[model samples]
Target: MTENPLKAKDEQPFVIDPIADTGAAKWSYFSLTFSLFYFFHIIAKYEQYTNTQLISVFVIYICFIALFFQAIRSTGKAVLKPIIAIVILSAVGAAINPGTNALFGYAAFFSGYYFLRKYAVLLLILNLAAQISSALILDLLSPYYLGPSLACSFSLFVYGIFSQKEYIHSCLQQKKNQQIEQLAAIAERERIARDMHDLLGHSLSSLALKSELAEKLANKQHFEAAKKEISEVASLARQTLSEVRLAVTGLKLQGLSGSLQKLTNELKNMKFDTQCYIDALNLPPMVESTLIILSKEWITNILRHSNGNSVSIAITTDANNVTLSIGDNGKTAKIKPGNGIEGMRSRVAELSGSLDINDDDGVKLTVVIPLLATVRSNVKNKAIVSV
Candidate 1:
């Protein structure tokens, strides 16, 4: 039994954390300045240089800084213009002062990381073209320096491209884990609630019926019969107390079939296009209950978060193994591994099973449990429901 993934009492709502990273307050500015800072020493040696020459260097550096900052801040289509402008302006500067080659390389690094991969490579090519053209025209393409420069710059470009993607994926994975933790906690709480209800519901119902009969018998002056009814009520109370203790200790009594059948009807009522494919292999009690809870939580997540129109679930097993897979065509790329997912994983691990979640076009989860040698069998029974 899983608790509802909703507010119970004063529990705080789960919130997706902000993903934007603020590593440096003035990253773009510092990067541009440091990359060109070494070249400024060269300007001091040009004896024929006038005020205009120094001013040209300062003005070019300032322009690249502004453009680089803008390109860094903007994303997608908004960045296209600034990046192009920066590349062209850097080319002109490189023609005047070969030192601007460093600026061009740094620009290439950022472009490769931020832009679409195909477009990023194109920008890198443009940067190379400008650098080679400037070097050739100035007769300054020395093998000693050119070899190292090209190797280092190209490496930065490639590294930036891959590392940024990896970083984003890592961030997304962390966020997913947080979500799963939150959901799993909710499910555990819900499980406790269900246990309490099941333990008390039947016992209380029986208690009420017997008490009413006892009252009627007493009013009719049937003292002996009323006493017997009273005694039965006492027995029920004692039994109920024992059952409550078992439930509180996490001894769940609900079976797999009962829960699945109820879930199928619930999904139908909620207008979900759901299909269930179950096998009839007389699953072990523990395995059956675990799977039932997993299925419920999985479906609940779909209905609450997947925004999916349809879902397909399949359960199958071999001579010594069971495989269960559930998939939905929905925007699940953003779904994080919340508490519910974590709880499911922990339970499956205890049963010597594995669970994997794939996020491609949608969400698909596959769970495999290796049956014990004593429990493994070859019989097949399929229970499928589609609506």
Candidate 2:
């Protein structure tokens, strides 16, 4: 079974360490600066302590600072051990001298950050209990120490929660961006495959037919006719090569009318009586490119499959839509959708268009695409440019 992404995210170890990162390290230094006040407080009253007592407090305070830094630098469960040590040192330091009570705030913050909510809360309660017990047992209970210590602990704990949330959000956003890039790459590859098929399919079929016609004429001793057919084949091959080059360079078809006329000539070559009609319409490059490619795909299908001798091609535009229809008086049969047909559908769908195929009389394809606002804008821009 596929694991839920949110659940997996919770299980993954954090990849960043606060103390090891430049920006986070600066903030760590800023927070650690506040802990110096307690260290200095002990120093200010050093005259009241014997040598043994003073040395013990100093050692405990140093160990607490070292462990605190280590805990922040560590990742995963490795951080827990040092954090637990810091909590113990905080309690021991408080018992030795109430001035070091502020150390418990640092412990509370680490526990909240490095653990889940329930575990962090339990650790927090333990820290509070340890502080209160030490103060009450040593007759050191005072509002001046207890009130500020509690406030600091809660404030830092909340800050830690917010920081953890921010980090998680950042990681998720990065993952989403990567997925979007992968999807775009796949779409681009499919587009190239579709374009190559439309460009080469018709040209290859025409070449094959012309080659056979030339060979038959040569066998009948009609040298001039055979030579003419071979010349046409060479010309068609060069044109196909140029189109492939332009397609690879991401350039759209330059002249829609010329392309349509060329298709009509190819139909006549196959002895098909073709009728063509095109309206005077201004279309955007992308729309024109899609129309030309779809036309090629349909004509190629007719040449390979149709048995009739007549074909009709029409392109017209009204106030609200552009329509393209291609039909042939061919033998009608069950139309099984193939890659070429599916590619045409995909192209039309991208323009928010509809395609219908009917085999009642003969095979006919009709496509209607709405006149989008962007298309109207392009037409207006072209009119201004012409003026």
Candidate 3:
């Protein structure tokens, strides 16, 4: 038979872990032991019952205990069947012995945990009705008996609601953590890919240019010039390999000042006027690395794409933020964001930073990153340790 959609939706699947299950079962059994007093009460009033009645009571108690263990161990939708059986068994056991009415509290607790709010309330009310009807039919109602039974059942049901909410909250938190981990891994992979492209793209282009020059010199029978070109190619290859190694190891051979100087020299070699400024401030390794890469990327873009012969680069820091601004005298009507721009944005965003592109006079890019608490703490700790 097919299950009811409403009932199926209301059920919570159990996680089966050996250690967790063992701990839960241990607590449950400890609590169940308290119910033994009811059995003791029955035995104490032995003179008021026949042998058949005692045997029936003992058999019912044993079966109820077995079902209770089953309910605790059961997983998934199967748990609801055993829980429902538990409720029925508790009602029957109460009819047989009014002292066993406490069993209804167990039923109410499980119902609240396994069922949705409305259904759990319905089950609690039904169990209470069953308890009252059984007590009335058997003429076993007492001021002491009914009040405590109802109160315990309600109290446990409320506890069950709280426990259910806590469990669901924990599950959501776990799922969120997993998603964050997965996203971090994806971002790392993208970062490596971008780094590789940036590192290799310029070097390979230089290699190709030098190789072509060497071939032309050889074709022209200028052995000396060709030899010189080949030597430069070999040196550039070694430098590229070293940079790749540094990228892989997540290290930078030069700090921000040194890297900016190298970039400015490169622009000068290309016959472009370059102005550069760097503030003397402590920077975290990640921020330094990101700025270095972005400087290289922007400089490369300027060399390859810009029409202007002048470029300006500035790095400045305030109390709360560090900013990098790069602009060229190249004329541009509109700015188009491509892979390089996207990569820069991604890198800046990872550090909770922002990137802006403006093209009013020439293409300009600005990156601003906040000195977050952790970064500031690291700077402070470094100063302390250095002192």
Candidate 4:
């Protein structure tokens, strides 16, 4: 079976590590810092070059120093440093020596292509235009000229193509995470709405009916019957309150047996016959809660959609997994599932279980969850080893 795409957000780590992100930014700064110091040291000791050579080195050193400062200055704006540094260094490299310029320009182009994800294409275009124009200027000024610069310029363009793909993938990952979070929030909201509707709608309708019947009985001089009806109405209201509280607190103290018995009594009072059976005992609390939730949702779906008069609920557990199946005799409705089924699926998927719904012959929903025996055993062994 395919993995559920709507799994709970908290069950898995979503965002990449903040430390890892900070580390990458820090490394970018550290690399440029080292580069600036190394190049500056060379210029400081060997300043006997021609005026143009000294000027070119000075420009390159200043640009790298600026990049180091910018990369560390603004924690949130690290994207600009690589882009600016790459452009400046590419220029200085080309101006100094055609051969060396070709190499350094390729490096700078790739750095920008990889780091400045959003504007990668634009940076590549700009780098290409500048390098080509610089090559033409060099050809006019010196014999050792245009061909090498053109080759370097072409190399930078070609390098950007490969790095651009990686940059785009990073951009896509960031967008996908945002979308997942939005979708998870929407799913959680729908679940809450369904829980509220189930808790209130049935109880309110019953309350209204009981109130009407009690009033009618009192008018017919059936005071004792009217008093009894009032008590039942109060009991129903208290139980509904408890259910609402349980749903809100999300406490698993109400095990599968308690939850099912509650459902059976509630439906019986509401004039629907329910039969529940279990072949499991002392199940994991999480597994028991999962079963209860599944039972509640299936029952709710039956009441709202199937119009079924009878429901059969069965639960069984083996050493490795537990299964719960609920079936109703009434034919399935053609009505689409709104919130109930969606919430059931979400809860079951959180436990790494599968919920199967069959609309044929009768409405049947089945859920299966893995037992945690192996995990418990592993923990026990680890404890023993530590001792």
Candidate with top lDDT is: 2
Candidate topping TM-score: 2
Error of 2 at 65 (Å): 2.9
Q: Which ten residues in a row have the lowest lDDT in candidate 1?
A: 378-387
Q: What would the per-residue lDDT of candidate 1 be over residues 134-243, giving only the tens digit for each residue?
A: 66776768763355446656987886677556544545544454567568657977988887887688889999999999999999999999999999999999988977
Pick by lDDT: 1 or 2, better one: 2
Error of 2 at 368 (Å): 44
Stronger candidate by TM-score (2 vs 4): 2
After superposing candidate 4 on the true structure, give the runs of residues whose Cα lies further than 4 Å from its correct spot: 1-27, 30-60, 67-103, 110-163, 216-223, 245-387
Q: What clash pairs does model 2 have?
A: none
- The 10 consecutive residues of candidate 4 with the worst lDDT sum are 378-387
Q: Tell how far residue 330 is off in model 1, in angstroms.
A: 55
Model 2: how far residue 226 lies from native, Å? 3.7
Task: Tell me each candidate's TM-score.
Answer: 0.49, 0.56, 0.55, 0.40
Model 3 root-mean-square deviation: 16.3
lDDT per residue as tens, model 3, 1-387: 433222224343332211132333455677786577557657667788788888888887887788777766655555566666766776667666667776778877777765667767887888888878867877868865688778988998897777666554544544454566568657866787799998799999999999999999999999999999999999999999978875664434357887788789879999999999889477865687789899899999999989999999999999888999999999976878999999999999999999999999888889999976444431100000000
Model 3 earns a TM-score of 0.55
Candidate 1 backbone clash number: 15
Q: Using lDDT as the measure, name the better of candidate 2 and candidate 3.
A: 2
